[model samples]
Target: MATTGVITVSAVVLRNAAGSSVLTVRKRGTTSFMFPGGKPEPGETAAETLIRELEEELGVNLDPAALRPLGVFRAAAANETGFEVEATVFEHPTVPIGGPAAEIDEVRWLDLGLEIIPDDIAPLTALMLPALRADPRER
Candidate 1:
């Protein structure tokens, strides 16, 4: 199905020291696992939105200057059905320090080659598998 519309935002690919795994989080009352991010506030840039969201949802502080552009990614919106999520993804190449802040209910580290992604995954994450599998950092 064609996307009804797009919800623009930013996201972080929080990787471990070896970059072999990526982190995913589940929001309160939500079954799907997705990257930590949210819709941008009016006039807010994508990076800024991601920065705020990471702190709000994960209790982790990200150095704004450290956010690396990972290009724009697109997938069906997990929460808003019939729509697409337009994500300006960033890379935070670090092992997150804290966990379960704000609306976050659970956290999981997805091993690119080993773990079978659950059906209850957000769209962007569903679209990310091939890249994660081919990523040199995951090798």
Candidate 2:
């Protein structure tokens, strides 16, 4: 049997302000902006993977107290990588620390209603945007 493992985990982080959402542009070789996260290491839980990824990718340490589970979504990897991904999404209140890491070329807060998020990430965005826009306080 061909096996498909969930290849990545991600988080939809909202700023303290209600109207914005975080998006990170991939470094030159990749396509589309995405939430801050990556593949999990051995034995790590989804939440643990999320926290570590956020720190490595964005340079911010997420307060466990502020981590809110959003939902999980599956999508084709944007890069045409054969592995499909199941992203466990979370919402968090964050402060920017050091600049975005090298893998991230740019970072911006997008208007949930206005940006053209890539198709691969669209499903996760679709699931979370409405609530983020309606109530920043919700996960």
Per-residue CA lDDT of candidate 1, range 10-77, in tens? 88888777777778889898899888788899988988898888888888888888888879988888
The candidate scoring highest on lDDT is 1
Which candidate number would show the highest TM-score if scored against the true structure?
A: 1
How well does candidate 1 score on lDDT at residue 23? Answer: 85
In angstroms, how far off is 134's CA in candidate 2?
4.0
Off by over 4 Å in 1: 136-139
Q: In angstroms, what RMSD does candidate 2 have relative to the true structure?
A: 3.7
Q: What residue pairs are clashing in model 1?
A: none
lDDT of 2: 0.63
Q: List residue ranges in candidate 2 displaced over 4 A.
A: 1-6, 115-123, 136-139
